[model samples]
Target: MALKLYNTLTRRKEEFRPVNPPQVKFYVCGPTVYDYIHLGNARVFIVFDVIRRYLQHRGYRVMLVQNYTDIDDKMIQRAAEQGFTVPELAERFIDAYEADVRALKVKPADIQPRATGHIPQIIALIGRLVEKRAAYPSGGDVYFDTAGYENYGALSHQKREELLAGARVDPGEKKRNPLDFVLWKQKKPGEPAWDSPWGAGRPGWHIECSAMAMHYLSETIDLHAGGADLIFPHHENEIAQSTAATGSPFARYWLHAGYLNIDDAKMSKSLGNVLTVRELVKEHHPLDLRFLILSAHYRSPLNFNSELVEASRSGRQRLQEMVDNLNRALPGAGAASAAAESRLQAALEQARFRFTEAMDDDFNTAGAVAVLFELGRDCNIYLKEGYPYQRGLLEKAIGFYREANKILDILEMENPGELEHDIREAIARREKARCRKDWTEADRIRDALLARGVILEDTPYGTRWKKKA
Candidate 1:
């Protein structure tokens, strides 16, 4: 089956088709870089990382571009509070954001463009809007004329009249309509400034993304994604300015990950319930958080609590234990009969089929996870039959686990041969005790191993050990 993705623009699942076959251009809105990324931000990052990985896994040459809004109002205010320049504050948080996502095993974007680095491109794009009369200059600032564009509110599915009724001009603004957004801002005292056609002021928040995305990708890209919160003025303005300027579609497909909640409440500093990836990783494994994020469909809200995270950690460990069992079973065990081996291969093929089917339906990661659990159960049933292990069966199962893990990222299977000899001997001794029904010795050895950061699980086939994450 062809891969299908949910498009926010159309509000339906559409078969994913690239404008240029075998090459996909993907762009996601990156962090503003004023503070450490919170859990909500981390969710969008992880969701898109999985999407990118799956696209590449399906033989698409994906080139992803995620940009940093390095010179926004938040960056300026936080820099002033910290007695540093805007660039310095942005650099600090950029590094923090990268470190946090890296711990979650997210791949870096092929092009990570910063707003400050693309001043010329931003200015050039704004100039085109002004030349086409889609934007106008007023009092040293340039604002996009929302009235000039016929499809200004098309992306967000809001009518022009409805938007205008709810909109109000902010204080110290100079624009004809309240719905019109600023493309360029006049320089102010104690703020970062750059030489531009409008004045020596920086680009506005929304315009920076348009310029950087167009500069790296093209006028019309294949995929554009972000959190659901950005579907409004941020992405809306991007569509208005980009399409109005270039006379082409801004992005062919629009994808948005749903909001992530903390204990059934919106994550916010005012609520004092906001969680950061850095703080969460201090207590739980990064893969645990990734698993929890993937437990829900990307378009559905995910509720996060301490209990939920603990449950996710246990779930991740369950998958990890299966991989360890298969790894340990393969070594020093005789091959299975040809008929038994054929059954194992068939089971593996069935699991792979179900997994792909789940993913093809709009990247349903939660459904894909259910398939993993079924595969784990099948492995246990085969292992408990007391027949000699088939190396090919175990290897094929491991291959399936690793393939799905490339997108899910729930398992961390290290080579057992690389383990220390003493640890290996302890595991072997514990297995022997269990076979001989020496319960006391087996329990004692398990406790000793647990104290040394090695967790042991006894499956019907045998016992497997892994270090605690």
Candidate 2:
């Protein structure tokens, strides 16, 4: 089945047809580098990373670009509060963002453009908008003329009157309409400044993305994605200014990942419940967090709590144990009957079909993950001691898991050699005790292994072990 992605622009799922076949220009909005990234931010990063991976898996060469907003009001304020320069603050948090996402196993973007690094591109785009009269200058600042953009509310699907109900002019702003957004802010004392036709100032928050995406990709890119929060003023402004300037669509498809909540509540500073990836990883495994995030549909709101994370940890360990069992059994596997091979092959094919079907339906990762669990269960059932093991068929199962991991990135692919020798010896001794009906000795060995964070499970095949989650 062809991949179908839900387009936020049209509020419907559509077949994914890139502007240029086999070459997808994908752009995701990155974080404002003023503080540590929270779980909500991590969700956007991970969700897009998987989407990019799946696109490549489907034979598209995706050039993914995620930009860093290094010079924004938040960065300036944070730098002042911390007694550091804006550049210093940006450097610190950009490093933090990278480290946090890397721990979650997200692949690095092909292009990580910083807004400050592309000042010229930003100025050039603003110049085009001014030339087209889509924007106007006021008090040494430049603002996009929202009134001039006929399709202002198209992307967000809000009527002009509905938007106006919540819009208000900020103090000291000079624009024709309340909805007019700043394109360039006049430089304030002690703030970072760049030279532009409007004067010495920095690019506004929304314009930075429009400038960087168009400059790095093209006038019209295949996809643009971010958190659902950005669907409004942020992404809406992008569409208005970009399309008005170029007379072309800004992005062919818009995808927004759902909001991530903390324990059924919105993450908020007032509530003091905001959980950063940096802090969360100190206690929970990063991969477990990734697993929990993927357990839900990408566009569905996800609730994060300790209980859910623990469940994900246990689930992840089950998959790892299945892989380990296959690896350990592969070395001593005997030939299988034709019937056995055929049965396993059919199961594997069914798993492949189901997994692809899930992913194709708007990247339903939760459904895809269910397919993984099903495959794991099938593997465990087939690995029973009474069943003959075919080395080639077992290897094929391992390959399927590795292939899935390329997209999900949830499993730890440790080889048999990586399993601790002492643990294996202990399991061996426990099995011997079991064979001799030495219940006390077996219990003692099991307790000892459990103390060391090694969990042993007695399967129909034999003894299987995995590290405690």
Candidate 3:
């Protein structure tokens, strides 16, 4: 089946056809670079990472661009509170963001432009908007003329009255329409200033993305993605100014990941429930967090808690254990009967089909992951049957896992030597206890291993250990 993704712009699932086939221009809104990235932010990044990976896997050459907002109001305020220059603060947090996402195994974007680095592009875009009469200057600030853009609320799908109900002019502002948003902010005392036609000031929040995306990619890109929270004024403003300036669609397809809640409640500063990716990695494996995020549909709200994370960790370990068992059994196995090999091959083929079907339907990672577990279960049954394992069949099973891992990126095993040694020692002790008829000792060892996320299954071949999922 061809790939289909839910486009927020059209409010429906549409078959993905880039403006140029086999060359996708994907853009995702990156962090503000003022503070450590939290789990909510991590969800957006990981979701897009998987999308990019899947696109590549499907034979699309994707040039992904994710920008850094290095000079926003939040960055300026945070730099002052932390006693650092704005650039210093941006550098610090940008490094932190990269480190955190790398730990989660998210691939880096093809181009990561910073707002401060693209000042010329931003100024030139604003100049084009001014020339087109899409924006106007007031009190040394440049604000987009929402009235000039007839389809102001097209992206957000809100009526003008609905947008106007919530819009308001801030104190000391000179916008003709409350719905109009700033393109450039005039210089404030002691703040970072850049030379632009609209006096000496910095780019506003929305314009930075429009300028950077168009400069790096094109005026009309394939996909634009961010969290669902950005569907409002941020993305809405981006659509208006970008289309008005270029006289073309900003992005053909829009994707938004759902909100990530903390224990069934929204994460907020007043609640103090925000969890940073850096801190969570110290407590749990980074892959576990990535797995948890993908366990639910990308557009479905996912709840993060200790229970869910532990479950995800166990699930990830279970998949890894299947691969490890295949490795261990492959080295010491004879050829299997033709019937056995045929059965396993059929199962593998079915799994491949199902996985592709799921992923093609709007990148349904949850369904795709279910296919992995189902395949793992089939492999476990085949191993337990004690048939002479064929080298080709075992290798094929491992190959399927490797193919899935390329897109999911959740099956990486760390320190396999050390872990294997420990499991071997524990199993040996249990075998000795069983031989001596020390049932209590054997049971205790079994329970202890189970507690440590290992499961022992006594087969006719011998006592075998797999991870507890």
Candidate 4:
């Protein structure tokens, strides 16, 4: 089956055919880079990251672009409060964002353009919009005339009049229509400014992405993604600006990950509940956090709690223990019953079919992960009970297990030598502490391993360990 995506613009699932076949030009709206990225941002990033990985796994050459809105109201305000240059503050937060998302295993985009760095491209886009009469300069600032774009509210599936009903245009600005959004903002004192044709100002939030995405992709992209919160106003404005200027489809597919709530409430300071990756990682394994996320569909709201994270950790642990057991018996994988081969094949095909099918159905990550658990159960059962101590059968089960995991983009194992060395050193240290009769020290070492998210098991013969992250 062809790769299919649910396009928010059309509100339907369509076969994903890249403008240039076999090459996906994907753009995801990146963070504004003013503060530490929260779970909402993490969910958006992970959703796209998995899509990118799956696309690569399916053999598509993906040119991914995610932009940094480095010069926005949030960044300016943060700069003033922190007493740092906008660039410096933006860089700091960008680094933190990268580290956090990398921990979540989000791959870096092929082209990560910062708004400030692409001043020329943004200027060119603004100029084009002006020439097209969709945008106009006013009092040293430029605004896109929302009324000029006939399809202003198309992406959000809202009418222009309906959007203007509850939303206010900038109070101090001259707007022909309430639905119009700013393209360029005149520089305010103490804010980062750039010399443009209109005046010394920075690219507005909506225009920055439209400009950057066009610059990187050169035309309408195959996929555009962000959080569901961006479905309105933000993404809507992007469509208005891009389509008006270029007279081309802005993006063929728009995928938005749903919100992540914490403890029955949104993760907001006003609500008095917030979970930071640094804070959460200190207590829970990063993979457990990832597992928790994968348990829910990308388009569904996820309620995060300590209990859910613990459950995810336990689920992951069961797989890891089975992996350890299977690895120890790899030399004897061949001696399997015919039933084992049939069982492995059926389970593998079912899981593979389900994972790909879920991906086709609006990238249903939750459903995909459910299939992964089924594969795990089958692999563990076949390896433990369905097969004799034979090399070929053990290897076949491992192959089937690894194949299933690959489809889900989960890294199953690393170098055996590397894993063995780490396990040996960790156990040796653990044993030395025990021998010295330093009960506290031994417990400390064990807890230290736990703190690193390496769950431990002591067998009569030896120790087996798994890194939770």
Off by over 4 Å in 2: 335-340, 416-438, 457-462
Tens-digit lDDT string for candidate 1 (1-469) = 8999999898889999999979999999999999999899999999999999999988999999999889988898899999989899988999999999999988999999999999999999999999999999999899999999898788789999999889976897799989998899999987779888777888999999999989999999999999999999999999999999999999999999999999999999899998999899998889899999998999999999989999998887877777877777778567655765455577788999999999989989999999999888888776776357777678788889988998888778665555578988988988889889999998999999889888887755556567776
What TM-score against the true fold does each predicted structure earn? Answer: 0.94, 0.95, 0.92, 0.87
Model 2 C-alpha lDDT per residue in residues 324-359, reported as the tens digit of each score: 888888877876546554666788999999999999
Residue 159, candidate 3: C-alpha displacement in angstroms: 1.4
Pairwise TM-score winner, candidates 1 and 3: 1
RMSD to true structure for each model, in Å:
2.2, 1.9, 2.8, 4.7
> Which residue pairs does candidate 3 place in steric collision?
none
Off by over 4 Å in 1: 335-337, 340-343, 416-419, 422-446, 456-464
lDDT of each: 0.89, 0.92, 0.91, 0.80
TM-score of 1: 0.94
Tens digits of lDDT, candidate 3, 74-180: 99999999999999999999999999999999999999999999999999999999999999999999999999899989988998889999887588778989999
Give the range where candidate 4 is weakest over 10 consecutive residues by summed lDDT.
409-418
- Candidate 3 CA-lDDT value: 0.91
Prediction 2 TM-score vs. true? 0.95
lDDT value, candidate 4, whole model: 0.80
Superior candidate under lDDT, 3 versus 4: 3
Scored against the true structure, residue 29 in model 1 reaches a CA lDDT of: 97
